[model samples]
Target: MNNISSISNPIRAPRAAFLGSNLHHHHHRLTILPRRPNVVVCSSSVSTPTSPSLSVAQEANRIGSLSQVSGVLGCQWGDEGKGKLVDILAHHFDIVARCQNEREAVKLFHEIKGATPNHVTYTTLIDGYCTINDLEEALRLCKVMEAKGLYPGVVTYNSILRKLCEEGRIRDANKLLHEMSERKVVPDNGGANAGHTIYNAEGKKFALHLVPSGILNEDTLCVIGNGVVVHLPGLFEEIDGLESNGVSCEGRILVSDRAHLLFDFHQEVDGLREFELAKSFIGTTKRGIGPCYSSKVIRNGIRVGDLRHMDTFPQKLDVLLLDAASRFQGFNYGTEMLREEVEKYKRYAERLEPFIADTVHVMNDAILENKKILVEGGQATMLDIDFGTYPFVTSSSPSAGGICTGLGIAPRVVGDLIGVVKAYTTRVGSGPFPTEILGQGGDLLRFAGQEFGTTTGRPRRCGWLDIVALKYSCQINGFSSLNLTKLDVLSDLPEIRLGVSYKHINGTPIKSFPADLRLLEQLKASGISYEVLPGWKSDISSIRNYADLPLAARTYVERIEELCGVPVHYIGIGPGRDALIVK
Candidate 1:
């Protein structure tokens, strides 16, 4: 096979004439005709001409004329009769080339051949688009290739990276590199507690909890890594829902065998734990994520792999149930409950068998194979257990470190980390929101942004963009770039505010996001400092290019970049994928 990289620019043939006369008992003639300005036609009388006496220039002109005729014929007719023509011309031509600029070429090829375009076709087209410096179209083709269950190889990614680098879009190039290197493992630290709302091309919303956002791309393997806690029933429900909506899940979704199982009892324990705290209840999704992790840490947890051995499953269940029962007086445990739970789990185990996998090996194997993995995080950094506000945070680490522990991947392989932040700040549950906009102001943002919890459906506390918190998140994650989402949410407001910093009640500046709950609560009450900027006050939802956005909107985006020291590469003007402005 000829390498596309070695293919030169389009060869232009000179307009020439070919003439032949009748010879040896037959009247034969060759004619050269011009069909259009750039098209040429040639007709030969002789079946096979042996012209040893012809000059080299004349021979070259004859061959070029024939090639031009073949190109014209190929363009005039569809794939019909193209094969016979190719076979006949195969001996004369060194290479057969097709126009890559034809947008419907691939679709036509598929329709005519009844076969999908192979990797070479996709890569060649992508490279061709890149050569012409149409990077946007190149990227779109890449996505389309992936959507058809074809993964882009190294050559394909390199072509895009090279084009991006040539254009001085280093951040975007780095982002592509990160996607090329990382294997996205949605770790054990998060379960179905967090939710990501994604909008499809048709404007249909998918509320994903357990499944990664990568599910939208057909070729992407969504792995629930070892660090994640799996709630099998919830996982299957999500799978069924997706499949019902025309998305396939069978071979695409993988649940790590080593991931601990979050049972219904774990959720009961979680609620009981919260009830015990009463007035000081930590705002949890009551999804049993914390209790499941607690079981894992305590060494009494049941992993997804345990379901394979049904014989000892009952014994393991008894131990877990007993542990929960002993802790809470309100908890009731009996033989009937155990028997019922065991029967239910048996069904769950049978259904979950196909999805279970040793993800550690899968991830490592993919890395070795040079497959691009995109890690999709469940929660924000501020909601991390170790790094986030104490007691108020979720049980797991939702920060950069979680990618390693959760996915069983080496830290060195983790590439560019892009933080997705809203145009304004909003928190679902209880925590110190230093930049909170209270009363009517908060209501305006809340209703405008539709700041409701995806998992819990609770009203989120809306506020101005908190630069202090964002900078701290950047510092923690070392994000290469930031994706500013929901910028269109602020279109209705006359002015927008960014919480620039925090201060003490007595006028001292708080430099960083403090971990102390007391200090955070104090700051939340009256210590936030704000920098107000003018809003665009016009709808920007239809914008796709960053340059087309209003000056005020661009200023708002750039100001955030200045404050956080991270480039805002992706600006989400609206919910749909097409609404994102690549800055």
Candidate 2:
């Protein structure tokens, strides 16, 4: 009777309860069988057959394994699915970490996804974590999160380490990185994925994109266009410098002249490109900025400093003038006449040096004193040099990197990058914009937004909002908040339309902006516009709060919030700064 109970009695079943009524085979079920001694059956109808020694070894391997797990970095530019990935991984990690880059991804995703799941919580994307100078606080946060039963992942660890390294805290970051790896949260060795190649008929071409150096949070990884190979870790450190570089407590509102120069200068060239891209739809202002920058890159530029040595500058200027004249040999620009203009610029360069200081020095000092400095960009992200529609865009980093290169301040000094967007979309220059609204719809938005250049007075080619483009801009700029401008312009519309995405030609859906102009045109031709929301009717200029706005206006703002995946923290009723509504 004892042997029967021990060997064959179904009453003494496996302690792990192999099967029950709740077990649904259709939903993937497991079965168990009895075995002698410590042997037991598992759900897969398979036995592990592991001995006690093997079990110990398996546990040890799991604890010690340095397996690679992907952390999302930006896919394209900045806002490439980073927020979504970070949010998803936040559940498994103690902290949602970042380096220098802001949480454009998280902010945008939160705006899109709306109310978070009960299990989810907010985490900071430390704007300049690499240079925050307070590794202790960041590490404490990680510890706090861990104390709550979460593990710190690469995003969190790398940012703190990057800042430490930037502050000449290399040893600290390395130690942290090593510790993170030991905990199974591997450090990202700053590297970019295989970037997209642009082929020309002339030869097999590849992009000359810039890649960053340093350790990166695993979350941002993508092959960008051009030759830009970004090491996110390095970028994080640069950003850390900006964040920690906090401005000095000063009374004056300082402006970065370099940025202003780039803005004023690039506008003309970019406008020309826009004019070319606009075809017959628009006019462009021919500012000599493009020629100037191109000349500078080719070592033929007349610098502002060259003015003090005017005698020598003009000789070099003549060579560039002659070269430019050759390129535009048969074009509208007169070669001989333009050479005289070069002399005129010499006088202008002489008068402008008093305005040029080591701008970075004063700006950095102000940052140290915690002064407020606004680094306003001239052109939109679509017109950026490396990331934007190439050959048709501006020759500068109008995105977040512009702050670094333009200001001479580290990434950590600049805080809270705000991205400005027009409610409906308009593109001034040429490229493949899938959301371009043509015919009457485009015409209406153009006229309503008064979509004309502030400096040039040229009309902008209008269309529905380009969410894809907007997202890209948000990512590259490290936008912490969004200023949704021109909401009042959409009031009179009976209905509104938005450009959601393109009907990709290759039978595959691409969420990103296309690099090939012809392919972009095809996408534009075949693209689909997703109209999910309607426009507002009320005059929103008077509305000062998010709740007081008209339902339609609120809905419209919310829709944009959802679309761009970045919250509209502030809305613009009109062009004036006073016309802001804070949500």
Candidate 3:
């Protein structure tokens, strides 16, 4: 009566079936009698029974159970003729059944259930339910057996719950755990079966490895791109302030020798071009990121190393300024203005000399010396040049792949790509957001998380965490772990919504994140679904330990890990660098 034909009847008890050689019984006929309401008794008729009305449970007590029935029947009643009859019938019970594209194994179960119906019988049925991922039904059956005074035991509970977690139903699995806790049902094996699954999930492929913070003795080096221009300086300045507060970086900082410089003029030119020149705004930081990258590509870009040779730099500057002046109608650079700029850059170059070097060699040498290198990715994955939303995307790569080209470092030298993401979603400037909270809700999060741009101070657009996009990012980077930040911002929200997946206008699900920009936007325009979790009241920002986090917050974090298949090794509770909960 199950979905899996007769064999998957959800009642297959252990000892119901067996496989062996030369098995024979002295009793010629084995009877399948419903001697009682729900029991089937399979016993021999070699000896006359004192009572013909005994139940299978009584018969099993009268005789031994599986061990008695499985092998040679009875030596006392053994006869060559009767043994031949039982041996001939053994083909029906002994022959292995391999059903392809068919149904088949509950026959043996029915034979055993009527006889014993003990604790082992009930537990086996529970295991059957778990194999089919039906914990609810298993728990219900467990209660029935418990009412009859048979303990289902921890073995049954662990088996069912372990399978539930494997299929990513950890939430329901946890509920059963609550019941077990209330009953004080300890595990029958080493720890619980649930723990084994998590251990297996985090085995070699996703093992958590922690190193002491600030392990870099040589110095901390950050690789930049158009990608980095708006973000790194602010971060370095904050590190300097931390140094002022007695938290020092202790090592020198290296900027790539080949990295295109973002001059003040580049920012000036970017603002003028975006607001004045183009038909469609590029939605830039007005920090000249794209222009600088553009300059790099066309072979006219001035780099950090170019500042060393002042005599030749002015000539490169003159060509650049003259070209930019002609291209931008808003810019008017007279010869005197150009001369003033030349002198201005000469002084700036002198100041930059100390920080500039052939950083590629430095990074390579650091690898040789076995010094750790931590590369911070610029911009989010959705803003990546090639893989992200086009037209509205940034000009340079912000992906893990970008680290190689931007830093002049090889890909093999890279290690432990940890992704930093907010508890909810937010993006600067403009782009398509699937789970965007457009009204007061978004504004609340914006205010709560200080969702403003580091470069332009523009208030960021906010939304729910998009698993579609997050999965895409995780797949591309093969992230070792995640650093979930701004979780405390959702504390005040009585109920927080999480986007799980996307569907089309016709309600057909998008199998994978669509490459078509409009199609991807369409998938979420009105159709992404959410799973809601209740919000926590505690101020998690000051809670430095993950175990100290509130129940609701833990549920939220676990749900995210379950969805993305990446553990949140570090949780950020507040703004300071110290405000991290390490798992």
**Index of the highest-TM-score prediction:** 1
How does model 3 score by TM-score?
0.59
- After superposition, which runs of candidate 2 have C-alpha atoms over 4 Å from their true positions? 1-284, 325-353, 453-458, 505-507
Ranking by lDDT: 1, 3, 2
Better of 1 and 2 by lDDT: 1
lDDT top scorer: 1
TM-score of each: 0.66, 0.50, 0.59
Ranking by TM-score: 1, 3, 2
Q: Tens-digit lDDT track for model 2 on 1-583?
A: 0011111111123321111111111111111112111122222222222222223323222212211211223212221112222222222221121222121110111121122211012123221222224456556656666666655544446557666767787787778777877888766543222111122223322221111111122221211111111222332333343235441112211222322222122333433443333322222333334544555567655443454566675576556545644554323344465556556656555544443344456655655664333333334566666787665565555566655654465766555555667777765433454566655666567767765433222234666666777777776766666767667888887555555555565556676766765566565545454553444566777655444565556656656666677766546675442355544
lDDT tens string, model 1, 179-216?
A: 87774411121112235556555776666556765565
In candidate 3, position 508 carries an lDDT of 77
RMSD of each: 26.1, 26.7, 29.1
The lDDT values for all models are: 0.61, 0.43, 0.51
Candidate 3 on 1-583: residue-level lDDT in tens?
Answer: 1111111111121212211111111221223222222223343444332223344355333211211111111100001011111111122221110000000001012221113344444555555555444567667878888898876446667767777888798898889788888888875442210000001111211110011112121122332322233222333454454456444344344445565665666766765655442223222334456666667678787876777888798888888887788888878888898789778777767755565566667656666775434443334466666777665565666566776665566676665565667788875444456777755677688778765433223345677887778888878776766767678888887766667777787877777766765665554445676665567766777775444566668767867787789876556676543455544
